[model samples]
Target: MSRLLGLLGGTFDPVHNGHLRAALDVCEAGQLDQLRLLPCHIPPHRQTPRVDAATRLQLLQAAIHGEEPRLVVDDRELRRDAVSYTVDTLHSLHLDFPAARLCLLLGTDTFNGLPSWHRWRELGELAHLVVMQRPDFSATDDPVLARWMRERRTEDWTDLRAEPFGRVLFQPVAQLGISASLVRQRLAAGRSARYLVPEPVWQQIQQQQLYAAP
Candidate 1:
């Protein structure tokens, strides 16, 4: 069978539980052949992490726990400079693994911000964009179908060409509604971030005293 690889990239500040579960969902729920645990060197919009890149990578490696036999941690971003960009990362991956089909995974909040991403249009040509499901689909729901629908207006049978260029696809998996920032806030306040992230990650956050300042 042909294989498709999913790339989940983030700072993974402490490689919390929710991030791991979401990636796992992408694999099992999306029937992904494999997943590459990509930890970015520098998150563009976010402030510099309290913990450095290596530390974050270490946390990611520890959190995998082998549930995803096909999952692997990719560290090219770490080897690169500051402020990592997804387009560049994907381009490099394309060069390194030319035959593999690359798909990016993100939540609704991130997906809604794609239009502002670096070289966003190139993404449509490079690989596919997979948006994880949120709550109900409101009419104002950013409508990922536009990537195809707009093109269809110039052609016939719009619905027939639903996945043109495989630009955008949505998969709504069950996940506890939580945020990483919230987890950090709870930890800093001496509150338990129970079941929000993996046990080891929470331990690391506490032991490392991460997110305690500011």
Candidate 2:
């Protein structure tokens, strides 16, 4: 059987419980052999992360420490020193793991904005897209995306194992209303993000005074 590898990429300005939970949910639900938390150096669609790549990486490591053995970190995007494009990252992963079936996990919001990404159309060619959606989530209204979804969407997990790429799976995960922005906002306002982020991550944030008011 081919190994199933999942990739969850983000700035992870400060790794939080929501991110960890979602990753673990997808990892178990999808039966991934390993799920890497990829922290991008430069996000193409969002503002630059407040913390540097090294600091963000450290926080991610802290958040995942002694957690799931399968939850690992991949820092290829940070080393690249260029705009972090999903297509480029997928290509690199394909090279490194030629036989592994790659699953690119995404939130519904990010999946909705797929049309705007660089070389977006080619995403399905490189890896399967696992969209983490709410149970009540409805189909997208965009005609182009709707059509694309119809072409690639699959409900069965077996379809992902059957092919190395080009399938889309919508998996419902527990929605924690936490966002990295929200965490940062609370910290900057001298508010506590105790349960929003892991204890170790919160400790590191305090130690470094990251995202605190200037």
Candidate 3:
């Protein structure tokens, strides 16, 4: 049986429930042996995170510390000091885990903007894409993306064990209507972010007074 390694990368400004839940869901859904929650140093697609990479990495460590094997935090992108590109991370992972099936997990929103990513097409060559489909998204609506999806779509993840890369699998997972931006807003407003983020992360936020108005 080929080991399946999953990578979920993001700018975890303050690791929240949604991020953790999505990581857990993808691990179980994809039967991934280890799913690394990667923290980006400089996000290529989005604005630079308000919090520093070290702080965000600390929050990620607190959020996933007790949970090992199933979930772990990868700081390669954070340590690189360059714009975090998914393709670069995938390429590195491919070299590290040559025998295992490498899968990159992304939400539907991310998948929809796949073309905008740096070297997006090369991503599939390095790792299988496990796109988490949302109830409201329609990737088929885009002519270019629709054609791309058509050529690489696969119905079974078992096929991943046979081949190392170039498969696109769309799997439906529980969509929690949570966002890190919302949590930050709540924290900035001095409101309760209790349920929105994990306790350890919440504690870290309070301890460090993160996202508080200056």
The candidate that achieves the highest TM-score relative to the unseen native structure: 2
58-151 per-residue lDDT for model 2 (tens digits) = 9999889886569989999999989999899999998899999999999998898899999999999999999999767777888998899899
Error of 2 at 73 (Å): 0.3
- lDDT, residue 183, model 1: 76
True lDDT of residue 25, candidate 2: 92
Give lDDT tens digits, candidate 3, residues 1-214.
8999888888987788888787788788777889988999989888889899999988889888888968988888987978888888887877778888888888888888888888888988888889887788776567888898888899887887678888999987777888888888888888989878889888888888899976
CA lDDT of each prediction against the hidden true structure: 0.70, 0.91, 0.85
Note the residue pairs that clash in candidate 1.
Answer: 17-197, 17-198
Model 2, C-alpha of 36: deviation from truth (Å): 0.7
Q: For model 1, how does the per-residue alpha-carbon lDDT over 1-214 read when each residue is reduced to its tens digit?
A: 3357788888777677667777777777657778898888878878877678888887787688666567789999999986788888888988887776777887777766676678776776766666666666432244653554244222211221333334456666667667777777787787887577777776776687776745
Which candidate achieves the best lDDT against the true structure?
2
How many angstroms is residue 189 displaced in model 3 relative to the true structure, after the best TM-score fit?
A: 1.2
RMSD of every candidate to native, in Å, equals: 4.4, 1.0, 1.2
Decoy 2 TM-score against native: 0.97
